[model samples]
Every structure is written in C-alpha cells, then in structure tokens.
Target: MTFVHWLAGQAGQTFASACVMTILVLMLFMAMKLYKSYRRNQTHLVLIIVLPLIIIQNGVLISLSDPEWSASPYLHIGYSFVSLLSFIIINFVFMKLYTGPASRLKGMPFFLMAIGLVVVTAAQIAYKPEMLSGPIAPGGVDLLALDFYGLILNFIILLNLRGVDQRINYQTSLIVYFVYQLSDMADSYVFHGEKPMLLIFIHLLPIVYYTLLFLLLFEWVLERLMMTFQSSITDGLTSLYNRRHFNKKAEQLLRDMKRIAIIFCDIDNFKKLNDTQGHHKADNVLKQVAEIIKEETAGIGTAGRYGGEELLGLIAAPGVKPEDVAEAIRSRVEKETMVTISVGVSISREGTSIAEIVSQADEAMYQSKTTGKNKVTLHPSVSQKRPRSESEGSKRSKQA
Candidate 1:
C-alpha cells in the first residue's frame, strides 16, 4: 500500500483503539467509585455504575461497524440506541444532582425517545436508504434524524449544567461527553473524507476527551477526601482545630521543642451570658473569641476550642513569652467583642508532661477568675514577682 493509504488505515485502527481504551478506563474508575460508595453505604451513587456500561456498549458497537456504514440505516439504529442510553444517563444524573422542577422532568426523556423512534422510522421508510450510505450529505434523512436526536440530547445535558450541586463529579463527565459528541458531529459534516492530517487529528480527539474525563474524576475524588479530612480535624462552629486534633498536634510539637507554653482561657460569666442572651448569642461570642485567639496565635502557636466557653493554645519557640500571647488574646477579646476572658499561662521546659502543663495553666486561670475577671496570670513557677506597673510596661512593650 502507498504510505498515504497505510497512514489512513493506521488512523482508522487508532480511532477504534482509542474508543476501546476509553471504555476500559472509564469502567475501571466507575467500578472503584462504586465500590467505595458501596462500602460507605452510599447507595445513591451506585446508580452511576450504569453510566460506564452505556459508554462501553456504545464504544464496542461503533468499533465493530465500518466507517462507510456511518450513515446507513443499521448504523442509524445503533446511534439511536446510544442516544437513548445517553438520555437515560442524563436523566439519572440530573435527578441525582439537582432538585425542583428540572429534576421532575424525568418522564421527558422517555417521551422524547418515543417521538424520536417514530420520526426516525418514518424518515428511513420514506427516503432511499442508498442515499444515506456516506458522510452526512445535506439532505440525508437518516443523518438528519440522528443529528436531531443529538441536538435534543445535548439540550437536555446542557440544562444540567446549571444549579446542580458543585461537588458532583458527573457534572464534568457529562460536559466532556457532550463536547465529545459535538466534536464527532462536527467531524461528520466538516472534515468528512478530508485531508489525511485533519482526519487523523479528528479521530484522535476521543483519546483527549477520555483522558480529560479521567483527570476530572481523579480531581473530584481528591477534593472529597481533602474535605473529609478537614471536617474531621476542624471545629464546625468556629473553624478552629477541635480538641482531639489540637492535643494530637500539640504532643508532636512538645516532643520537638525545648521550651513550650500552654495557655488556657475561659470566658467570664459565660453561663450567665448564655442564659440572658440565649445560646445563639452565646455561640456568636464563642466564634468571635475563637477568631481573636486564632489571629493572636498566628505564627506563634496553634489555638483550638478545648470545650464549651474555653480555648487552649500551645506556643513552642525560644525567646517568646507565653504571658505576652495570653495578654494579647485577653486585650483583643475585650476590645473586639466587649467581653472579658480570664487567661492562665504556664511555661514548661524539659521533663514536663502535657497534662501537667495544662493543669498549671488551668490552675492559674482559675486564680485570675477568683482574683478578678479579664486578667492574665502566669503559673507561680514562671512568675517573676515584678511590680504591677513594670509588668504592665513590659507587656505593652512586647505587644508593640
């Protein structure tokens, strides 16, 4: 064969291979996702398993058919079958991802399918079948009917692009599928039997389409896993690290540090505030205080909600005073939220247990509560017994 003829044959085989590979890869991902959802008891996502099956069936049928049969009546029947399956998949995805009137349009697919089948059948009977046996000629009824079905399917798929849940992976998959179909349709009319280079490139488009689908699926899966991890470690109300995550991280920090500071803070008269202002208002106060603590601890330590109306912070660094941080937090809470917090700070060196440090801080904080609200107190071991004015001057200097 001439090189040109050889290249054409290779291109055709490559197109078939691309379709087969795409089907295999899609099926693998769908199976993995299905298995994961099944293990999680998320049966709602199990229906997605059927989508890859539809694509696989379509690919297999297309690979088996000859290019010359592209517009033939039998080929039209194959296309109709694929279109119907696509409609089924689209309807399922729309209902699963969206709600309201659009989701209620479930029966529309069946209605359209029935009308399409009747119209295609009549068109095939009325027109000469021989005239439809090539790349979609202008007036060929078979190709027209197929094109009409494609347009309607694309319209339905496009509707799904709006107002659907942002987290749904199938959204990107459907978009890729729609673009693939549109490219196929464009190639049929615009590049049919064209230059060798253009034809080869056109045939290779499916490989790109399927590869994008795989990447989008991988991205979706990774995002979900990250979100799950974040939710587990974070406080839902204040977005601070929860107590469990805080302790786990603090233990790691303590092991690596020579000097560590632990600060325990509690809102004064918090129960009275909740009773007078309601739990909703109390929650707002907690959130505001958490934000202030987080801001104050930024770059110096990690802060978290230890329990109701209480927060804990860990600072591990040389030449940094824990008392300064406690005072900073106290002042910010008072200034920003018009509320008072009693803060207790403890500095630990070698041979100090996490529990011991926390206990010291808690004890000092209680001392502040007893003495007066909105004051910072250091553990007796760390306190220098400086005059009150000098200590206040030192705190102001450190804050500056």
Candidate 2:
C-alpha cells in the first residue's frame, strides 16, 4: 500500500479510538454524578467531553480528505476556522465556569491573541486549498504559519490548565495536550516523509494521544469520585464538613482522653430569615454562616454541618472551657449574620466517649432554645438549671 494510504488509515483509526474513549469516559462520569446525587456541574462535565470529541473528529477528517483548490476552498477554510474557534471558545467557557470569573482574566487574553492565528490559518487554507491535501514543506510559509498557530493554541491550553485549582485535572490536561501536540507534529512530518516506519508511526500517533486523553479522563473520574466521597462528609450548600465527619472526629477526640469542649449552635430564627428573605437569600446566609464558622475555628477546632440550621465544633484545648468557646462563637456569629446563635457547650473530662459528650451538649442546646434564644447554655454540671417550662418551649418553637 502507498504511504499516504497507510497514514490515512492510521489517522482514521486514531480518530475512532479517541471517540470511543471519550464516549466511555463521559458515560462513566455521568454515572458517578448520578450515583452521588449532585445536581450541580453535571452539564459542564458533559460539555467538556463532547467539545473535544468534535474537535478531534474534525481534525481526523481534515487529515484524511483529499484537497481540491478549485472546489470551495472558502467553505473548507470556514469549516476549519469554525472547528478551531469552537474548541477554543468551549474550553474557555469550561475553564471560567469551573474555576470562576477571575481565571477567565488570565485565559481570555491568550485566546484573543489566538484570533490572529485563526485568521491566518483560515486565510492560508482559502488562498491555497491544495496545502490542505498534504503536508507542507517545513521551511515554507504555509507550514510555518500552521506550526506557529499550533504552538499558540497548545500554549493557551497549557496556560489555562495552570490557572485551574484542581491539581489532578491540571496535570492530566497538561500531559494529554503535551502528547497530543507531539503526535500532531509527528503526523505532519510523517505525512511528508511517507516512509514505511513513518506510516506505522502515523497510525500509532492517535493511539498515543487518545490513550493520554483516556488517562486524563480517568483522572477526572477519580476526581469526581473523591468529590463525591468528600460531599458525603460535607454540607451540600455550605461546603463544610458534615455531621458524619464531625461525629467521627469527635469520637477520635474523645479517645485521645484529653479535656475537649463541644459547642452546639443554632441559627436564631433561621426559619424567619428564610421566610422573610426567600430561600435564595437564606442559602447565601447559610453559606456566610459556614464561612464565618470555618474562619473562626479553622486550625484549632473541627466544625461540622450538624444538619440544617445547626453546626457543631469540637475544640480539643484542655486549657479553654466550654463557656468561653461558646461565647466567642456566639458573639462572632451574631455580628456577622445580624442574627443571634443560641450556643450550648459541654466539656468532657478525660476518658469520656463522644456519644456521652454529644448527649450532654444536645441537652444544653435544648435549654438555650427553650429559654428565649440568643443566650449561651453550659453543661448542667457547669450551669445552674437544665429544664425549662413546657409552655415556654412550645411557644418558642411556635415563634421560630
């Protein structure tokens, strides 16, 4: 068989492989997202997988097609421009959506500069459609322009990866794009040379790139897996560690046999806040409350989203008393949320279990809740009285 025929066959196979891997990986991610029951960001992940499939498939088609200058060169050029532009634009949107708007500042300029490269490539294709049929001389303007354009695009892909927060995603994308560019350059050269080994090498190029892409995709799957695991132990709306992690950590703290303090806090009339401001505003308020809680107890203590409208923090400081931590948090939360927190504290002496400590803490919380609100309650041993009147308790619950 001719070199061109062999190389073309390899290109076709590479494109097919990439398509297969993309479909499989995307389906796997979709399954993960569904299993985890996360409602947000699933669509974004789908777009990320689908957009590349389009670009890679188009590339393979262009590589295999025979060029005819007399035919609609303009149409082919337009198609090329659309393909490249679409890939870049979709990638930009994906980056921004996932990483936030600030990340776009760094990537948008790079993409804007790429506009010139796209224009040049399209112009080249339209002016000389025959160049599209086969590889160009390395030293020629057409090849030079295309190579330069590729360099810019590759650089932008890398730069965008760098700005992302997800470490595995960034590294995997970098590796995949790096190998892909290498295979792309090698394919160009093999097309020109047409040697027997080069034909085989050309066929193998897509396999390498596709394999790397698949690996990157698996990294994404792994990341999503990690996120799902993390979410189970985290508050869905506020992103703080959930009650499960809190309970586990509290148990560990108990086993350490050190004097530990537990603080239970309830957002004062959060139901009223939700009713007055609407759920969206209430969500923002919850996030703000979580942030303040996280900021305050960050290194010294462990905070957990103890179900709705409540949070728990465990401070393992033998020197600090339960009342002090409760007071500090209550004051700060009141200031930030413009709403009070009825805080309850329970301190466990050495050798106490987490369940016992929690039971004591919860009883204290109920006391605070019954006695109006906004006030702090200490463990029965530390404070005067525990129970409040049933009528008062019923009234407070009704008001809330």
Candidate 3:
C-alpha cells in the first residue's frame, strides 16, 4: 500500500507538470504577439526568451518522470535545479516591468537576484539535502532546509518589487505562488501518503499558481491593446477626437437623430498670440480654451479638434439649442482664458448631411470673424435669436 501511494504521488506530480506546460505555452504565444505589436517593449522581449525556456524545462521534467522506469534520483534533482533557476528569471524580469516604465531601476534588482541564486545554489551543494529526489517526508528540519531557503529568497524578491502598480493586482498571484511553494516543501510530510483527500493539494497547487499568473498576463495585454486603440482615435495634444474619427462619429449620429447641430469655433488672433507669446504659451492658451469647450459640451454633445486652432461640437440630444451652447462656449472662453473664440451654430434641416451642416456653421463663423472678433453667429437658415432664459447667463460676453 505504501509503495502504491508513493507511485500515485509521483504520477500526480507528472500530471501537475503537464498542466503547467499548457499554461506556459499559452503565455509564450501571448508574449510573442505582444512583442510583434510593440517591438520596443522590454517586458515582452524578455518574456519571449523566458517562456520558451520555462516550457522546455517543464518538458524535461515530464520526460524524466517516465512512469514505467521511475527515472534516477539524480535526474530528478537536476531537473528541479533547472526549474528553480527558471523561477528566478521570471520573477526578476516581471518585477522591473510592474515597478514603472522608466529606466530608473538601474539593474540593482537584477544584481540582488543573481546574488541570491548564487548563494542558494552554493548552499544547496554544500548541504547535499537528503532525498532531493522525491516528495519530502516528515523528518528533521534539514530535509526541507533548501526549500525554505528558496522561499525566503522569493520573499526578498517580493520586497524589492513592493512598489508595483496596485491596479494590476499582482498580490493575488503572489499569494498563490507562496502556497504552491509551501505545499511542495511539505508534500509527503503533511499527507503522509494515507490522506489521499488532502494529498491532491501537493499536485494541484502548482497548476493553480500557473493559472493565476496567466490571468495577470492576459489583463496586461488587454490594457495595452486598449491604449493603442485610444491613441489611434484621439489627438495627442488636445486629447479630443481627431478630425477623421470625429467625422465618423458625427455621421453616425446624423443618421439616428431627427435634428443635430454643429458649432464651429475659431480662436481670435491665434497667430498673433503664437508670435508674441511663443509656441509654448500659445499651446497653453489653446489647451485652456479647449477645456472650456469640452466642459460646456459635456453630456449634451461631444467636442473634437477640427484642425489647427479650430474646434467643433456636435449636439444630438433633443430640446437642446445649439445657439445657446455656442454662446456659453464663447462666454467661457473669453472670461476664463487669455483670448476669445468666434463661434457659429447651425442646425440640420431636412436635406442636410453632416458635411453640409458643418459647411454652414463654418460660413457663419467666418461672418463673426469678419464683422467683429469675439461673438457667436447663427447660420442664416436657423433663427438668429438667443434663448432668453440662457441669455442672462452669457450677458457679459459681447455679441456681434
């Protein structure tokens, strides 16, 4: 019966390693995809090398644990040592990534990990741990001494990685890894080969550890993909939808809504500001004006950077007057920033497409720019009167 239980334990170990091999292979594919997407990313580059090595190491373990012959004790020891080194490699690379994107790490952590690996290996060689071959059985502390040393070294690595981004939630994976290591060290001792119910933990814990790490990696990849998508659609300077994407969204809204409005805004004397104040100051003022436009258009509509110092807002909501929103944007820009903006509001009538409506708004904005610098104008096709209720809110801003 004792011999049967030991054989079962050995088989379970092989099964656990097989499950981890599948997870490592999946991780490798994701890493390769990430590297292909971002050639400059350091984390993805290291993962491409590390994951394949880890996968090969796992395969070596599975090959050595051949069920029929049970392999040699020395063979298992050699496989275990290689697996331990893989752990060190994986942890070191990821710790740097999670800390920050900057190259501020300066390799101190790598030095620490390398030194720990050397010391641990030297001690294991000198101590010559008995039965480094199979499940550790209940005995003197010396039997599990090397494992405890490795665990302590892992804890030190965790300390170095303490400032990881909390949003990533890596702590959960760390907890699982700790349990897997502890179970591996206490495997035969705790189960004693009789308690089969609890005995499965020794095999299953390794799989759980790998699965958690894989989930964390998947989440990281998802975040990078989302960021890439956002950058493609938005203006890098203003953080507003760029002209192309804005046009796409506006057309979609025009198709669904019975009536929509476009407000075109052009900054007054923007080139003069750029000439006198320098590009940096001009940029600051432009950002301030953009902020005002964004705030006024929030909820009722969306704003976009049309081009240069021009901006556009599209209102799709019913019962919302476009002329009033334009006046509010003009008033706020004049009051809150170093300069003013000339705005024009145009509403869609039956035959108008997004292009036609925007063209009408642009003509009205040109009217305001030519007649006087800082005010709002409504397209000739729409009523020119301001809503009386909102006029008091914008009374301080001069009109053309």
Better of 1 and 3 by TM-score: 3
- TM-score for candidate 2: 0.53
Number of the top-ranking candidate, with TM-score as the measure? 3
Model 2: per-residue lDDT, tens digit, 224-253?
A: 679778887888898888877888887776
Rank by TM-score, highest first.
Answer: 3, 1, 2
State the lDDT of candidate 3 residue by residue for 46-157, as single tens digits: 8788888788777776665464333344555555566666777777656655666553455665667667766776676567755554543333223254477568766766
Better model by lDDT, 2 or 3? 3
- The model with the greatest lDDT is 3
Worst 10 residues of 2 by lDDT: 389-398
After superposition, which runs of candidate 1 have C-alpha atoms over 4 Å from their true positions?
Answer: 1-47, 65-72, 87-141, 155-160, 164-183, 186-191, 384-400
Between candidates 1 and 2, the one scoring higher on TM-score is: 1
Q: How close is candidate 3 to the true structure, as a TM-score?
A: 0.85
TM for every model, in the order presented, reads 0.76, 0.53, 0.85
Q: Residue 281 deviation, candidate 1, in Å?
A: 1.4
Assess candidate 1 and give its TM-score to the true structure: 0.76
lDDT of 1 by residue, 1-400 (tens): 6656544454464555557566546646664664576474332243355555556555544543444544454555565566555555534543443444553435565566657756765675467666545554332233555666666665666565454445255555556556656655665666654556554554555555456545554554676678789999989999989989998878888887767898899998898888988899989999999998888888888988888988988888677888888888887777678467888888885788777888888988888777755778888878766311223533332110
Better of 2 and 3 by TM-score: 3
